[model samples]
Target chain A: MTIEQIRKTFDSFLEEHLAFGQPEGLYEPLHYLMKQGGKRLRPLLLLLATGLYDDRFERGLHAALAVELFHNFTLAHDDIMDEAATRRGKPTIYKKYGLPSGILTGDLALIYAYEQLVMGLPASLAIRLMAIFNGFAVDVCRGQQLDMEFEMREHIRMEEYLQMIAWKTAVLPAGALQIGALIGGASEEEAAILHRFGLQLGLAFQLQDDWLDTFGDEQKTGKRKGGDILQQKKTALVVYVLEHGSPEQARHLLEALKSDELQDAEKIAAVQGFLEVSGAKAAIDELQRKYTREALAQLASLNLPEARLQPLKMLAEELMGRKG
Target chain B: MTIEQIRKTFDSFLEEHLAFGQPEGLYEPLHYLMKQGGKRLRPLLLLLATGLYDDRFERGLHAALAVELFHNFTLAHDDIMDEAATRRGKPTIYKKYGLPSGILTGDLALIYAYEQLVMGLPASLAIRLMAIFNGFAVDVCRGQQLDMEFEMREHIRMEEYLQMIAWKTAVLPAGALQIGALIGGASEEEAAILHRFGLQLGLAFQLQDDWLDTFGDEQKTGKRKGGDILQQKKTALVVYVLEHGSPEQARHLLEALKSDELQDAEKIAAVQGFLEVSGAKAAIDELQRKYTREALAQLASLNLPEARLQPLKMLAEELMGRKG
Candidate 1:
């Protein structure tokens, strides 16, 4: 089946699996959030990765469901922790259901996700999949902690910023790819390579997101430019300028951040100016390119039939080729 | 090994295994909660259940850690949801570190728990244990939801109250015993029987706790009497009285609860009087006795060597022998 068909089928699978549970109060919010879909990036990535080794990619549907459910569980809890108002352009679970349901929904979603990890898989594969997923799960928490810490911290190094993004945004898709590949009967070595490919791909995607949040058109990216500036989020660009820029540049950036006289647009402009002049933008641009190049190299090294690899290749270009 | 020895070793095992993780902020509160140490009853019960069929009960230590960690995970989050100030005579995680840590700690503890379930076990058993645990974890969430519902709810049926308590308090120890028995190579039937034993035992224990909170001496129970009453918690005793009492008795109970004139001690006296006269107290007592008897019968049916079963028998006697 085509990717589009698979996605439709996945929606059916997700609803059929998690839509019903007793105590409607505890479950309706979870189903509500699941229905309010994102890109379904993690599960689709897993399914695509599994297709690399096996033609019957549908067999990995359970693993795909597990990844998606687990990802959504994090989102529900993270929304609560972040006090986020909307997800997928709609009210978050915590906002709609109140705090207790918010917490309970996330908890229950996570428990259900664990069952999916080994739900129908054989014993040895289930254990290995669990080991991989557990490590990834803990790392995600560490990343989240660091991100929250960065918000409260006075200063952050570039490496620390990267670490936070790697954990928060990068490893999830990477993990999905690795688990899917493993489930598709890929060798550990092959799956490891696919994981590296996913890491580079994910890193490039996150960097592009950071770039788009700053430099891309509001009309195109669909987000107002320089939201990170307004929130004082220490994105990779912000950290690079702070950690590596000259004192004047550093002072200018901080002043742009703290000064009341400048309007939000002016403040964003000032930060953008610093990014351009300090060459952090160019460096980050080059870094994204490097990541994309590395990701492509890994995918190419797999030596799979081109017909089999075409979808992932096309995905790489589609994700990276967007203008920023 | 003696049960006491197993408990000590379990503590050491828990520390050595879970004491290490990066991002100290995320791991510290988890370590802190695990350190504060409740009775460690679940793990000990699991180890003893394992011993019922196998002498190498220590091999079940990882499963013991998993159950204990999962239990603590619940307690940490529950404290947040309950807005509890203290647990085990100390400030709770949320109380000490704040809300984010409270939620994140529970999340991390649970993820770490999934790891422990299969950390050393063979694949098939590991999968079975996970399947069992996932159900228990979800039920606990359902139970907690019901509890919150019961709080706001004006009228609760007897069956719903029993369902809430069974989910919230009873299934945890039951799941532990069943898992340990499985690891010890008990047949599904034997493990199922052990689970039933634990269910009845846990229910009886919770009922006794309710009874002790209301009727046991302050010196013996060590809690402020009528805290549940003051909070209007729907414990078995309260639910029974509401469900089975005469209309006058029910109205009198509500009046005592709502009246501003009565002092705290007077409210306690009034409720205790209602419990004594309404036959609810006697009924709950009989129910507790029946559960204990059933639990004992399940244990006796195992027909193990007396020496092997003696410790669990002693535990049953000690727990059930408490005065209220």
Candidate 2:
């Protein structure tokens, strides 16, 4: 089935299952965020992976919802930690409700995610899924912690930054697809291969995100260009500039990034110019392509029929090609 | 085994199993809270319930730790929500570490709790335990939401108050015991009975806490007398006064409670005097006795061997007689 059909199936499942219309403060934010949908990439990937081994999409629906819910839970809490005012073009949960409500609702979302994870699967499969789900959950939290810590630290190596993003952004998709593979009757070896595939895919995905934030058109990305630059986020581009640039260049770049004297637009333009001069933008793109190639290679090693693998290949390509 | 022995075993298990010494900021708060070590009541109840059916205490150790970890996770997050500065006579996680760290550490604790819950258990039992654990986890969050909501409202009915505390405080104990029973190989019927028993015990436990906060000697309770009253918390004593007193008396009590004009000492004395005059103190004590009796009766009805039931009865009695 098409990704759209898979997303529709997952969407209806969430609407039917997620608790609603009670305890307005707690459930309202939940409904608000869940309804304001995004790419639905994780769930769609999960379903497609599951489809490769099993035709019974219904079997993977709850697990798919579980991934989606867990992803949103992290987003809600991360918005609070980042002090982000908006998400997906709307007020964040912290802004829409309040801090305490945001925390509680994020917590509720996580608990419900676990509930969905174990809903109707056989005991053996449910236990396995939970183990994978929980391992990634902890990794995601740790990743967020490291990201927060990075903001306060003075220096971060390229290796450290990659590890951070791998934990923060990559593992969820990796776990989702691997979980899908397992639930779809893949062997342990097969699941491990898909997990590797997802890890590379996730790396490429995040790099593309970093690329889009600075270079993509606002109309297509649905976000202002260079928002990350303005926020002084330590994206791959920044890391690249820090690593390869001379001491003077690095010092100047840091000054330009941190100077409150500069207007938002000025800071972004200055940082972008520095990145261009240092060839950091091209470096980041090259790294993204390398990971995307590695991900496709992992897919090739799986020995699945080419037709069955088309959807995943298309997803990886679309992620690479996305303006957003 | 005695509760002390069981606690010692659980502590050792935690030491061997819990991740430590890495990501100091995230792990430290978790260690701090877990090490501070309150009553450890939930895990003890779980062990005792498990003991009723089997002496394989080692089998339930991980699950017992899961309960303790989960309890601490709630305390850490709840401290942030209440903006509390201290817990168990030391600085809270939020006070010592900061808000974001506290939130992240609590999240890690919760994730690790799930890990502990599923460790070493067979697939079938793990799934059953997880279902029970997750259900109460959601209920506890709902209960907290209601409790927070209560602070903003003018009036809360007696029934609503009971339900709130039951969800907020009682269900965890109820679930812990039921889970222990299941792990100990109890039939569904037996687990249900223990659950009912635990519900009554939890209700009595919370009411006793309400009584102790207002009336018990501060020296013995390790807290100032009337701390709850000072915070204007709507406890059973206040609920009783509202239900039993005349409208004029109730109005006077509410005024005295709400008035920032009164000194803390004067406010406590006024509310205490009102409770005494309205016989609300006696009424609360009576309710506590009723629940305790019902709890003990449920235990009796379990019809276990006399020796097997003694520990639970002693626990109930110890809880009732505790000065703190």
Candidate 3:
């Protein structure tokens, strides 16, 4: 049940088994993007949850892989849409392989995710998994579409951003956890509780991500410092400052957001200064802690033996405080 | 059995039962792309094949829609890869929504195609459908990857081109007809026969498309005359010409392909001239006729009443010869 043990197992599964076919130029970009490491957190969570109940974790490996592959698929396609040139300090799949290959590879990943999900489940369970898997995919698309719409808008409400991320980033993990529980022979109540636990964890995870983009150690995060600030992203921190700042302070923040000529350091300092005075950082910290606490509480409410749930609780705490 | 009736049934089924949440931007690009006009030949084939048994073709509407939607999904992504600005005289989905939304919409379409298949079949049949659907999707991706490889090669072999096209464009329709037959309660042997029927028709359909690109009247075909020649596509005609043309003609063809300096009209005429003189036109025409006759013959060989399959036979004849 140790987090390290769970991650080791997941990585071995990916490395040994995920050898998809190449379609010349089309596959290289997607392959390149996926090979660039993420934390492998989503799939790890599913494995941990499944292992929580049954010792038979390997049976659910394809389900976990399905989530990871789908996550990478979204990343590849989103990079193309956002015109992002690099991911994790290297060229993005689209940049490396061009738009068509990026699109096709992303597509292959998605279709293959479904293929993997169907490999191990019983017929009735497979239908349920199909519904869950397909629903996650459709919601991710909906969220990306909304994210695009947000880009063109002059202002975005906090609720809208939360809803968007819930659809885009949160639900896949939640759905995956549910599938993991189902496959592991957990009762329906246990499955629903676990699903909520993963979702809340995801929400907190995303908020922490937004916070790290501004204040994180560049060595750990491996992104250009203040990158989101330079882009004038309508993130949670910005939304909080805009809604709560004094009238004059709000005007300064708005002017800074709209000004294209501000230097990178100056922009970051200006926005950070405004957010500090507005107490936006404190508000976000409080909100993040609330969600994290709620997620842990949900985990504790599961009637499963505490020893079985020990690894998940430790993993959740680490995720909340993670620097990268 | 009428095409108009089949279209109506498919449209009604899609509108009434897709179970898709009305997300704001999710379906916009797909709606835009699907509404643009083309002959819905793939779906029509499924409906016609179903009619070969009984008027229970209505039960197969969602399955047929899956085929068409999957086709358009590939088209949308392919347009992005090919950098095609226009499709059917309108801007393609990528050009309209940009790569991110285009990619997301295409992914959504592919998943929804699976959903439609699941919904249209019984649980027992749904499991079988997923098995077939997964294999078809993987093959399509591999074909697309190989096609990108073809674009970069100076002299792609004819066998490779056929393999690529069979995987890329032909297999889905081939699978779709068989799925239709299965949905309508045809035996495994009967389904296999219809599958061969569809595959042959698909091959002839693609070959005829290649022929029409150069030889059809510009006024009748919406596409610009000699469009494939201008693009230097390694089509069947070009392959034949490259293999059989005299040394001087081959050199001219190579020069046209390598040099961007040749004016569009001049390049088109040069390629056309080489095709004619080398008898590549006659050779390809004979090949197209061979497949067409074989496809119709396969249709006749199906152990069904003649009246039941007459509509499909007529549709194939029109498809092979029609300019638009």
Which candidate should be chosen as best, given DockQ against the real structure?
Answer: 1
In the range B97-207, model 3's lDDT, one tens digit per residue, is 877767777888888888887874667787777777777887888888888888777676677777788889888888888887888788888878888877777787788
* Clash-forming residue pairs, model 1: none
Give the CAPRI class of candidate 3.
medium
- lDDT by residue for model 2 over B241-263, one digit each (tens)? 77777878778888989999989
Give the range of the ten consecutive residues with the poorest summed lDDT in model 1 chain B: B246-255
Clashes per model (N, Cα, C within 3 A): 0, 0, 0
Count of clashing pairs, candidate 2 = 0
lDDT of each: 0.85, 0.87, 0.79
Q: Which stretches of candidate 1 lie over 4 Å from their true place?
A: none
Per-candidate TM equals: 0.98, 0.98, 0.93
User: Candidate 3's residue-wise lDDT over A1-324, tens digit each?
Assistant: 577877788888877666556455555555675678888887887887788678987778988888888898888888888889988778888787776677877888888788778776777788888888888788878888877888787566778888888888889888888888888888878989998998888888888888888777788766666777888787788877666666676677778877888887888988877776678777887888888999999998998888888888887888887664
Sort every candidate by DockQ, greatest first: 1, 2, 3
Q: Which CAPRI level is candidate 1?
A: high
Pick by lDDT: 2 or 3, better one: 2
Those runs of model 3 whose alpha carbons end farther than 4 Å from true positions after fitting are A20-30, A217-225, A260-262, B15-23, B218-224, B246-248, B256-267
lDDT of 2 at A165: 88
Expressed as tens digits, the lDDT of each residue in A74-124 for candidate 2 is: 888899888899887799988988888888888888888888888888999
